[model samples]
Structure formats: C-alpha cells, structure tokens
Target chain A: MKTAIDIENVSFAYNEQPVIRNVSMTIESGDFLGLIGPNGSGKTTLLKIMLGLQLPDSGSVELFGTPANEFAEGTRLGYVSQHSTDADSMMRVTVREVVEMGRYPHAGLRRLTDKDHQIIDDALKTVEIEEYADRRISNLSGGQRQRAYIARALASEADLLALDEPTVGVDADVVDQFYELLTELNAEGITIVLIEHDIAKVSEYAETMACLDGELYEHSATSEFLKSGALERAFSSARAVSSRSVTRGD
Target chain B: MATETTRQRRELGAVALGIPLVLLAFIVFVVWVFPPLFELFWNGMEQLFNEHWLVSSSFLQHGFTAGVLIGFTAPVVGSYLVNRQMALIGEALAHTAFGGVAIGLFVGASIPVLNYPLLWALVVAAIAALGMQYIAVNTDGYADIPIAIMLTGGFAVGIAVISYGVVFSATVESYLFGDILFVPFENVQLMVGLTLLVGLVVGLTHKQLKFITFDREAARLARINVWLYDTLLIVLTALVVVAAMQILGAILVAGMLVIPVAAAMQVTNSFNRGMLISIVFGQIAVIGGILSSYYLGIATGPMIILVAIGIYLLAIVR
Candidate 1:
C-alpha cells in the first residue's frame, strides 16, 4: 500500500519546446514498471523527473511520502544514467574501486569500513562479477562493464533502482541474463523502473506498464495492457520493406 | 599449491629487501659522498638557512600561505573544471593574470614587492577570466577559441608593457622565472590568511560543489543554486592563480594545478582517492623539486613540474 513515487500534473520543456505535457503517475513500492514509447516520446524525460534530475515546470513530485527536495541523505535510490562512461583515461582503477563509489553517500569523507567492503563484495557477487573484481573496467567487455555498473547500484543498498535503456549495447544473451537478474531483485522487494524500447520482450518481465506519448497515455497491468493492443499502437508505425519473389509462376 | 605459495613468498621477500636497499643508497648519497664533492654546497646551504630565515620564513610564509590557500581553493574550483572538461581555463586565466601584472607595472606599481597595485591587477585578471568563460558559453562550436584568444592577447600585452617601461629597477626576469628566495615576510602573512579564507569557503560549500560538478541538471532539479557554485568556483580559481604566480610564475602556474591532479586520476578510481593522490603527488613534487633545485642550482618551479610530469609519464608507461 506504500507509494514509492508520486508525480502530479507534470510538464517539461527544453528551449521553449514542450517534451512532456501534463503527465501524472504513481508507482507503488515493489512494482516492476516498464515505460514504453517511441524514440523521443519523452520516456527518458519523465524518468529524469522521477529521479529528481530535472524539474517539471508546473507540477510536483514526491518520493517515499516526502517532497523530492526534502528527502534525507542516504535514502535508498539507485540510478544508472545513459551517459555514464568509463572513468577518464588517466585513471587505472579496478572494478572494486568503481563499485565502492556507491557507498559514498553513506560513508562521507571516511575510508571504507569492513561492513562497506562486505557490501561491495556481496554486490559484485550478486551481479556474478566476482571474478572481474580486480580487473580494470576499461578492459572488460560491454556486458561485463554493464554488470559492473549494476553492481555499483546494488552496492548502494537502494530500495528503488532506475535504469535508462540498460540493454542498449548489450548482446542478446547478456540482456536476457540482465532481465533475469532484475526479476530476481524484484522478487526480493526492490522496486524496479526501466525505460526500454523492446516492448514485446520486456512485457514478460515487467508486471506494470506505463505507455508515454508526450503525456501519460496509460498505466495498467502489463499483461492486461498488452492484451488490449496498447503496445501495437505505441510501435505500430514501423515502415515495411517489400521484397520481390521469383518462383515457378514465372 | 605449495610451490605457488613459495613463489609468492619469494616475490614478497624481494620487494621487502629491494625497498630498503634503495632507501639506504639514497641516505648514503645525501649524507656522506655529496658534501666534499660539492664543497661550496654545504656553505651556501648553511648561509641560506642562517641568513635567509628572515627571507626563508618570508618564502616559507609565501609558499605555505599560497599553498594552503590554493591547496584548498583550487581543488574546489578544479572539481567543476574537471567535470566541465574545461581544465585548460586555468591556463588561460594565468596568462590573463600576466597581462594584468604588466599593466600594473607600466602604471608605476612596484614589481617585486606585494602591494595594493598587484592586488588590483589580480582583480582585473579575475574579471578577464570570468569574461572569457561568458564568451565560451555563448559561442557555438568554439569552446576553446575564447581561451586561446585570451592567452595570446594577454601575452602580447605583457610584451608591449615591458618594452614601453619608464625606468626598470627590478629585473622582470625574476618574476617570469619565479624567485622564491625574494619572498618577503608580509607576503607570507598575506598568503597564509588568504589560504585560510579559501579553505573555509571550500569546506562549507563542498556538497553543493560536488553536486554541480557531477550532475548539473540534477543539482538544478534539487533546487540547489547552480549559478552560485559556478561563480564561486571561477572566483576561487582566479584567487588561486594570483596566489600561485609567486611560486611558479605566471606561465607555469597552471602546470602545478593540473599535472599532479592528472597523475592522481591515472591510478585512482574514485574522485576522493584521486584528490588524495593528487595532494600527495603534489607534495612529493614540491619537496623533490626543491631539494634537487637546491643541490643542482636549477630553477625550482620547473624542477617541480618536471618531477610531476615524470610521475605522470611513469604512470602512463606502467
């Protein structure tokens, strides 16, 4: 019955051009929500508002019953940004060091304690990346790197995890495994919110769906929404390419 | 498994022995062999410590004063510069400060001594630095152009002022090359006071600066004042530039700010670790360069920078 995120009549614009208009939605705790829309349909922008990374011009957002701005430090929120890149070239830090950054809000200015190290190790283990703990992040494959990033989020002990197209550059096998991991985490009561374009595949993993179209189009149970042809319309405008056939008729 | 353990043990033993051997050799070289080989070295060093205390204290005062001020302030400003990928802005500001110093000299301000005239010159330099940032932000596809223009223009101004000087009593060479030996007591006191003020500001605003540096949009969304932190960073940079100019000279000041930080970033994964490494590496450069300069009779600032660059190169090679 606890609401994790609440947004009310939110609108956003960039350079005076509207991107999101009068949108409102509430996500409850333990919900696995998938946001689906075509490219540039304001899915990412809406997520940004939820993450408190961007402001809505005319509305308000609250996380865990507190105003977004008034949330206390060390509140369990995890974010994996689209623009997160490998650290600068001059750095030669290992995977362990990068994951340790997630502990920063909890342990300010002090060295990592034994408990922090245990959390980091456990997070790495949860991501199945304990083997790569000592390896440099740059040397890892794209899938491995993404897993490292997930470990960083896991290390934060976050109650809510927000990912922006986490499967963008990953291979099919890794993507499948990543979804499995997400489901496992969801089973453990961590709320998951993700913006994904692979609507057909993601519907199996996500329990709830929010279809965005410059506004909040629909928010309903994922299976029920898909059965009602919601996703078909969201991605219905794909252009088909025709191919000529030479057969026995000729 | 037993063989593997033994092999590891041997490697560890080698490291333990190798480190001590190197330290022993260095101690012997510093204490025993070098004194008689360079006879005048000990006498000059003795005189430097004895007669130069008044002057050394002044220089120490200057170095510590400037070091403490810049050490605390530049890093806060640097947090933004690193995030913005505008690290070169510090270099441009140093050059602009050079121009301010030239104009101050041409107007009959004392060159070697710290005075109100030099302070006003620093203010002009700070304004110029801010102006350059504005231009860079407003222009499209030419982020580095404004900085490049300021650098060249500032140097040209310095040249013109030096050529048209009325009567030159102090050699301009010392300022350009940096003569830490000439630092007076008053300058030292001023340096220390300024550094403390900068430190307090940085400490108080640490979280705000970090938020803006890592994610500006998020900082804005959280309703944390972005412009206030941005302006504070630039002003702090300008103050650090003026303070460091005495020890490293105008042309070389930016090197000290950037090189150690760059090196630290090479080996650390976290921002906090990078900062700690940078301070440690910077101190090493300062101490090593000073000792080498005193022994070899070379320029102190360049020596320090060379040591830092050497560390950077070693990190790269490894």
Candidate 2:
C-alpha cells in the first residue's frame, strides 16, 4: 500500500521547550487515522507540519511520495483548521464562495471555470448542503458551518484531507453525522487524518488511532488497541480525574 | 408563499427603479445646471478649459480627465489601505508631503535654477512616507508614535518654511486648498499613467496581498516574502497619495482614500465588490463635488471629500 503520509524524527519547539519530540508515524492511503492528545500536546502543530504550513526542526514530512517542501502547488491536499470560526466572522460570503476558495490552488490567477463550479456543486451536494449553497456562511449554525467546511475540503478533490478537531463545538448528534460523512468519504478511498480530543469518539470513528503526548504512545488498529487497554494506559490520568469526580458526586 | 413572492417583486422593483433614478439625477445635474452654474463662478470653468486653460481648450475634457484620473487610482490603492488598516498612515504621509511642498517653495525662491517645484515636493514627501514606514516597522514600543511625530513635525516644518519667506504664498494657498482648475495637461497624463500602473500591479499581486492580510502566519509559512510585499504596498500607497494630493491637496487626500472604501464595505459582501463599488462612489463624489464647488465658488478638494463623507453617512444610515 502506498503511504499517504510519512513523518520521520519530527520535532518542534517554541523557544526552548519542545512541544513535539522526535515522533515518527506513517499513514497508509485510504486510512481513517485519528490523532488524539491533551490540549497543547502538539496535535495541531504536527498536522501543520504535514500541511507544509510549519517547519519541523529535526526531521522531514513526505506527503504522497514527495517531500513536503517539494510538493507541487495545487497538489490535492485539503485542510480544515480548528479556527474555522475566523472565516465565519469577516465576510458574508456565500457557502459557494467559501467552497470556491478550495479550488484557488488550481485556479490560480484565472476566473473560476465551469468545471470548478461543477465540482463545488458536487461537493455541496455530497455534504448535503446544496440547499444552503447560496445562503450566507454566517447564517449557518455551528453544525451546518462544520458541514460546509467539510464540503469545502471535499471540493478540493484532495486525495488527503486533514481536519484539526472537526467535532469541536458541534452537538453530539451532529458529531455522529459528521463521522458518518467522513466514513462514507473514506469508503470512497479518500485518506482522512482527524485530530480530535474525545478519545471515545476517535475510537468509534477511526480505523487506526495514535495517542500522542509530547511523543507517540500507541499506534495500532482502533479495535485491538481498545481491547488491549492501550487507550486506558495512555489516558490513565484523565480517567483517574473523571472517576474521582464521579465518586465525589456519589 | 404568495406574500413572499410579492415581497421579492417589490424589492426587485425598488432596486431597478432606484438605479435609473440616481443615474438620471446625476445626468441632469451635470448637463442642465452645470454650465449656467459654471458661468456664475467668475468663469473659472471657462478659464479651466479656454485660452487660459491649465491644459487645453476643452472644459468637459479637462473636468472629466481630472475626475477619471482621481476616480480610478484612489480606490485601487485605497482597497489595500482599508484592508491593511493603514488609512491613518496615508493621512500622516499627506501631512509629510505638505512639508515637502513647503521645502520646495523655499528652495525654489532661494535658488534661481529650480523650475519644477512640485516635483521636488513630491520627492521629499515620498521620502518622509518611506521613512515613517521604516520606523513604524522597526520600533518596538508604540505603533502610532512614529506617525504622530512625523505628522506634527512635518507640519511644523511646513509652517516654519512658510514663515521664513512670503515669495510663493498664493501658490502655497492653491496647494493647500486644491485648485483642480490649475491641474496641467502633463500632470493629468502623469496621474492617469500612474493610476493604471498601480492598478495593474495590484491586480497581479492580489493573491499575495490578500494572503498576507488574511493570515500573516500562513503567508510567512508559505514563503511569501511578507516584508517585501508589505513595503511594496507602502510604496504604492505613497505614490498614490502624491498623485492624489495634486488634486485633493495634502489636508484632504486621506479622506478620499478612506471614506469611499469604508462606505463600500458597508454594502458589499466581498473585497472585489467593495473595491468596484468604492470606485463608482468615488467618481460620483468627485464629479458632484466639483460641479457644486464650481457653482458655489468654493475650494474643490474639501468639497469633494465632504461629499464622500456624506455618502458614507448615508450608506450607514440606510
């Protein structure tokens, strides 16, 4: 199987403190990979490195067999940031315009072509937001906005889609729906890397899971890792805090 | 459903009629009332276009040439200025350019050889603009300190230059008040050429500019040469200010750069649409203001700027 992402000895630091230490991981094509960690545990930073939006101090990232730096412009890579709210506040751009930006890498310096419009339409339909295509993006609720972003990513025709905390701020039912949408996309052979905080949801949705805390801890099939108590070991402190709270309540 | 359809029809009807009514009013003012009003203003319009014409013997050509030149250029650079939140910097640069004009007057009187005083003034103003940008970027503590100092200090120098001698007081007043009647053919050509150049540069570099404005960190990560683009924008702004100051004067040029874009932003949903609307609004303000100023025998630049501000107010209220 072709490797979708390869990270070797990747490390990052702000000032003197290391955020991510010499971590190495590989994701195969068509894998629904979930990266989970505590807040400030370098999950987003690692994803940025893969997106070529940040430089790693000690190692390299290769996406689609090309070094991250050498990846061609307009290469099929889609990213949905945690701060998608920022895009929400500034403009009353329609859902279609936001998705149209996904085609920007390919449509550089040229007006959007018919094919681009068709792709955007297809993406909106695929994410089931076609009815809201002409609606102002700011008018959409949080769940609807999240789905709109998903459509934007889908419109890129990207072979690899990286989402940082896609389920944050979304209601539980919507979160499940979002996961179902991702599962359908994955089944269609698109590689997805989801950065998430909820261990239960990540385990439920991802085929492969990696628990990171300044370093990689467990990397294995989600079902086997859960059966082996690997997740509990990685999140023992969190579990302890939660159980203590439950006992106090009782 | 019937009510909704009726409401949509009414709204569409209003827009369709409103656009044509505005156009008609503009035409009536320009054609029917403007010529008689021009005759009443001590023949300033006649002088602007006739034998004493600053450029040539065509009043309509001269007014429109000046109007279109200011209309096209200001908003192109103004769009970026609004996006960067550097509208105040344009104001400071205008004040600094005024100092340059004062220096030009002083030098022109002292030396028997210097002929193109405005050129010297623009050069000094451009230098001051670039110097302020450098200080603002390099200084650590306060962002507005450098601008405040430059604006006040430059104006003080201008006052000193004026007090030192009285050789070109009338010309200085024209510079301060902005006499569109005095705009020569050569200056009109220059303004038109610079406007086109700046507009083309902006069109080519729109992506880089938008990227930097939208997300500086992302732009830096993309190896976009942020500092280079920032300085390029500053220099472009300086050039636009110098060109615009010739018609609008130093004191009022910044208003033209800012108010139209601000008004357009209130109504438009996207950056490109905002820019286009701003240019359209700017032209309306200039043309209307000039005709009114000619009729009332008042200074042209402030009148135009005030008209633009009025449009902004109306847009907000609406």
The second chain of candidate 2 has a TM-score of: 0.78
Please, what are the lDDT tens digits per residue for candidate 2 over residues B1-318?
Answer: 001123333543664666567556545655556546534543565565574433334544455566667877787778777666677777777777778778888887778577455666668777886787788777775767887887788788888888987756778776676777777655655565566557755765675566556545444433445676687787777777777777788788888888988888778666667778999989988987877777787877888998899999999999
The 10 consecutive residues of candidate 2 chain B with the worst lDDT sum are B1-10
Lowest lDDT 10-residue stretch of candidate 1 chain A: A241-250
Q: Pick the candidate with the highest lDDT.
A: 2
Clashing pairs in 2: none
Tens digits of lDDT, candidate 2, A134-220: 777777877788788777667767778888887778888788888999999999999999998888888898999888766787778
Candidate 1 stretches with Cα past 4 Å from truth are A57-60, A65-74, A86-97, A106-125, A128-135, A154-157, A237-250, B1-84, B99-173, B192-236, B265-277, B280-284, B287-299
For chain B alone, what TM-score does every candidate structure achieve against the true structure?
Answer: 0.74, 0.78
Model 1: per-residue Cα lDDT over A35-137, one tens digit each: 8876666788888778666668879988888766555532277776565542322244477866775664455323469999999999999999999888776
lDDT of 1 by residue, B1-318 (tens): 001123333543664676567556545654565435434543465477785543344354345334444544454455456656667777777777777777777665555553343465477778987787577556776677887888788778776887887535353554566656655544444454455556655654564565456545433433445665677777777777776776677778777778777777778655656767777777777767766777788987788778879988986777
**Hey, what RMSD does candidate 1 come out at?**
12.9
